[model samples]
Target chain A: MVTESDTGSIQVEIIPSRFLLPATAQKLLNEIYGNGGIIRIMIHGPNLPRSVPYGPGRGSPIDENRDLLIEVGGQAFELSVKVGRIRLELESEKYYEGLKAACERALPISFQIRRGKFFHTRQTITDYAKYGKVEDTRILGLIDPKAKQDRLAILSEENVAVHDEER
Target chain B: MAYTPQYYPGSTSVGINRRKHMSGNLEKLRDIPEADVVAVMGHRAPGADYSSTHPPLKEMGEPDCPIRQIVAPTAGAAAGDRVRYSQWTDSMYFAPSIPYWRSYWGAINCKGCDPGTLSGRQIIEARERDIEAYTKAQYDSEMTDVALCSMRGCTVHGHSLRLEENGMQFDMLARTEMGSDGNVYAVKDQVGIPLDRKINLGKPMSEAEAKKRTTIFRVDGIPMCGKVGARKYDEAVDALHHMWELRSKWGFRPE
Candidate 1:
């Protein structure tokens, strides 16, 4: 269960002008993760299906841009979507500057940083129906509730230590 | 008194480009070989004879009618060619041509053709040979920016999506890919069937060139409702508004 103090975390969304390649996304993630002020991060984009979903090419293999692996903070995971927008939950308002700097260092194209409520603060009815009594509120909207496998990739110990120290 | 047809109304570059497309006065940008175009189309093998639906008009005597006599049969129609279709998905991010404009181009320029315009993609159906000629014309002209437009026969889902970092439009089937040599290539047919060899589609236009050539009125480039800083409807909008007003009035009372 998340305490009342955790509800005050600042949320920021980074929307790039173009969908980033897996390597570019990894670079961006590494840069941002290195900054140490982020509590949680979620990458969002259009899904790259494993097979041709419909039409005459249905069931055909689509290898390009699908099943890509990206490492962030020493943890690697398969990227299902082409990275377009990245939403972050920061410990405080002070971390916004660091986040902006990280984006600048990694991105070659223009991007927009918007500060607002982008994630669910608490579990909803749908979350209850899908997840069945979620314990960690931070993981509330990180992934699709009906996803077969957990998409969350926990970073290394040092990164978790930094998050723990901030708390 | 004589009146010239004003294809589209606006002082902006977008309007001018639209007019050029509708008038079939597009500048030839590349010379993709007919065989390569045919391969990308995936209808038949290169150098193969066109399959026909019916006997040639010369052999199958037509009814002696004034309409039939006045309209001379096109090459494909005279040869009794099969009706075939070609579809294109143009990126919304400053693609040279949009679905509506493509339909307009087909309607105004092509003979014995049917053009369909959807939200994301546009398609033209004509006799097999005629469609091939039309497809080649579009591929060779400024109407198609290879990176921003693609030949998608089915599962057309990339028009409104953000482009890849390399600037190529998002294609779910991976029909086309940008080669390391800086030119785009079609590795697969329009329907996602792998081609025997990659066909070079020439270099993509620069961002500035695409913006200048694009018929879409975008907020970042040229806004349909207003300029960059100013707030005034473009001449195209005004013309459309006038037409709508007259249409509504006529609809109420057909005099």
Candidate 2:
């Protein structure tokens, strides 16, 4: 019942929930980059809850904030997260290795990772109607407004760097 | 001559695991320090002298009874230690131990033990020291995985609930937490009281290890009736059937 035109490139995060915290993800990224390597981190998970449903804390706000401050190697990078998979395609083999290690550490042991095309690699009609522009890369198809506003700045490897030593 | 005892039947991994638990012969996988176990139990503080309800049995002269003289009391009973309990909730998602099996394990292996089996949780009541020892055995043995099982006196959710996105069971009272180092740390007692410091419970089981050690038979993992010899050779089922057929004919007055 599904058609190709209706689909877009997307990612599936098969890992458990605890590892998606910005701080924890940053720690994992730091570990991979610590050993003379350059890599980009892609985070994938369920949609962050927007509200608290019941009890004395009923209707309280959940993780509604789309922006997070990710700290890796003492450096702080402001990342605007969407409700879906955040992909990383970079210029080094270490990036893949780091991504694998981080995922293994973060996800449950029973989950599996598959290699394939998941996200829309091309701009859609929606993008043209909404943004009045076509994205050059396929990774940014179904992103949040904040992520779009940032214009791929958050995904830039230049945003990641070790913090100044004198902290 | 004594006959060899067989604990359970079926060639499936779940059946084997059940036998190992009933037999009390599974190897201990990790060591949670004694004080840590005590802290989590919340009956008494670590190193605190057990509060007694009665004087020592030796000090309190007892009326002569033949059964009392013939059978020995457990260490806690002997010491006149107060009765205490440690309750555990196991995630049905491939947890190494389940409620009914835990009850069976305690009844067969522990002295002066009274194990309560519920739908989602198991509770064992024994004299202070005896229950502590039994609790430690369950915690350290292959029966428990830090992420899949938790000590909860109340608010024992996550049994049927899908594992928290991290595959860990978060005790409702916030008794346990997954540490940044990826190990489980118990910061609260079983009853939701906070401890002075956290106790490290150690690493969780791998997926393969958990599947092999689990007693829960599932279609995705190892189906209960799907195994080669399980349906045909299940000794427990056979025994139950034999009892059931006779019971229908004989009623309660088997004699």
Candidate 3:
């Protein structure tokens, strides 16, 4: 288990003026991942439900802006929410300027980068109840514990090298 | 003395816009075809006959009463048309009209109608023909911007959410899409039913235009309590405060 003092990572949140499309999100993610100082990143937005959740059109298929596929750092994942805010844990405060520069290059609209403790440093009772005996502390509060599928997409040099060799 | 109605009180643009809406004196922004409006409403097919609920008022023959003799029936009521409804969801981002203002407009202008206002949506129910007329007027007037305000019967979400990258409101069903031709089009009806053909809603107004025309008060545009440099309550707020004070005082002791 990695303690908070051991890592000494800093958290920052990137908030855009508007929600991003899948293509735009992919571009932003690639830019941030390429910069190579991010320890972990969490995307936040409103859920794009697969079917109509309520009202007269209940259970109807909603094809638009749902189940979008985005590739970042050669890892493709299905995005279920509209990209609104991106919270990143950096190795140190030195990478904050680089992160802002990355956002500037990827986003056409105005954005704000706020420095704060955005992520939960330690697991709570709910996390323990949902995910019994967590082994990886880095992913403590990265995702919704109740979600059936794991939303994490690990991007490492070794994994990329293996993917490139296979290709 | 002839009594003149003052719709609202304020010197800000929002107050002016509210007065314009309440007085039914909005500028016509677009001319969406009658058939297209009908298609988006999804209540009945375009050019189809309006179904009736009862016999014509003249034929039905009301009882001999003073109120009945004085009040004339509306066109739809006279024709014995069934009651129908239209609903709208307006974005929080400087939408031309909000739910409360829309309800106010309906109460002031329309006859024999029920206007319901919710946090994110507003609905009006009236006789079939009258509702169609009201819907068409709202679509064509400056009260609605196609990108920021949309007709939504069910699953009415996205009013308080952030807008899409293209400046359009975030609709989960995506009933409307911005076409490559720089015009908005309705591919699906208000209830998420796919339309037989796309209905072209005119181009959306620019950000500056929407801000100028909107009734909502925002810190970025114009705050309800004046701007940062000059912090003061608007005239409308003062009026409301006066009314509230009188109401509370009267309720506590009626003399």
Candidate 4:
């Protein structure tokens, strides 16, 4: 039951895969859940690969200096970012060459993973036959660090890939 | 016994005698009673001797100030349909001498010689001074006062219509009673001017009678009252004439 004291208990689902920029995703997050609280969950898109850095790479070193964990409303939450390159690395890349190739070809998409259960849910992008148009409300929430490659894959699959190569 | 006939020279029964035989005329005038004169003139005539020979009406019909015609019924008509003749004229005067006399004698004459001792220039100056004083006094007296027409100057037999200067504008004061038709008609003046003309009492007198009186009141191609700028003096006089003609249809004759 939601009460006046449950003000801080409110959670926001950020669909990072939907928004174009990180700032746009953050703005939508601020609008829905306000600015002061912790963003509890992120539902990463299925097409996005999951990968992390294993060995020391040739390129610039990752700055893991910043605290990845943020405290909100007395609750400790883990911050996870979805990168398309990380997703590609999870599926195929085993060495520095694969990582570099993934970095070049793959788009970065991230989502916050916390407590095993999915708080953010995905809405289906149906064919134009069942629904004439898609409404913004159908997009339940945006995932942080939107998945660009996943969107490309979805557009190509729908056969509505009009401005692909240049865009 | 035979009675002797007494005869006064240059005497006639009509009572008009030469001015020279004044004493004889006086005695004869005394013998005739005041009532006899009234009886001869007629019982309806005004008690005053306001005959055509009177100074005011004497020159009335002359070219100088042409006589005004009567457009209403004469005084001899029925009770509800009679017209009476009444008129008054204003005479203005100028008295220039009073101020000049006072100033000249008070200032200059007191310091100087008598009449015989004065020089030619002094005489001319004195005469000029007197003339100036007289002319100014006359002008002042002329402009100072005006004779107003009022109910006091009116007669019971006829309604009185007065035209007086109201500030800078001229207006008419009409005093009258209701007619047989229950509509009040202004008493037409001796000069045929109606009191207030807005009522359309002169032409096409009423809605029903309009067709009959239209020809009489229409002048210069317009009905007198409806004419443009009818409030102007000449237009007003024309309108008054129109009203007079309407009243005359009822047969009121001016004396």
Model 2 interface root-mean-square deviation:
7.8
**Candidate 4, residue B227: CA error in Å?**
91
Docking class of 1: medium
lDDT of each: 0.88, 0.69, 0.87, 0.25
DockQ ranking, best first: 3, 1, 2, 4
Winner by TM-score between candidate 4 and candidate 2: 2
TM-score of chain A of 1: 0.83
Supply DockQ values for each candidate: 0.54, 0.05, 0.54, 0.00
Candidate 2 C-alpha lDDT tens digits along A96-130:
55557666674333344444444555666655544
lDDT of each residue in A70-90, candidate 3, tens digit only: 988887789988899999899
- Our tally of clashes for model 3 stands at 0
Write one digit per residue (lDDT tens) for candidate 4, span B37-134. 22221212324432221233333343433222333322222112112211222111111111222233223322211221111011111222232232
Name the best candidate (by TM-score): 3
Write one digit per residue (lDDT tens) for candidate 3, span B1-255. Answer: 998687999888998999999999999999999899988998899999999999999899889999888888889999999999999999999999999999999999999899999999999999998999999999999999999999999878989998999989988888899999889999888888778898999899999999999999888888876545666877877998999999888858555
Query: Which segments of model 2 are wrong by more than 4 Å?
Result: A1-167, B226-240, B243-255
In candidate 1, what are the lDDT values of residues B1-255, reduced to their tens digit?
A: 899688999888998899999999999999999999999999999999999999999999898999999998888999999998999999999999999999999999999999999999999999999999999999999999999999999879899999999999998788999999999999888888778899999999999999999999987898876566557767888998999999888858655
> How far off is residue B123 in model 3, in Å?
1.2
Clashes (backbone N, CA, C under 3 Å), per candidate, total 0, 10, 0, 38
Per prediction, the TM-score for chain B is 0.96, 0.92, 0.95, 0.16
Candidate 1 DockQ score? Answer: 0.54
- Higher-ranked by DockQ: 3 or 4: 3
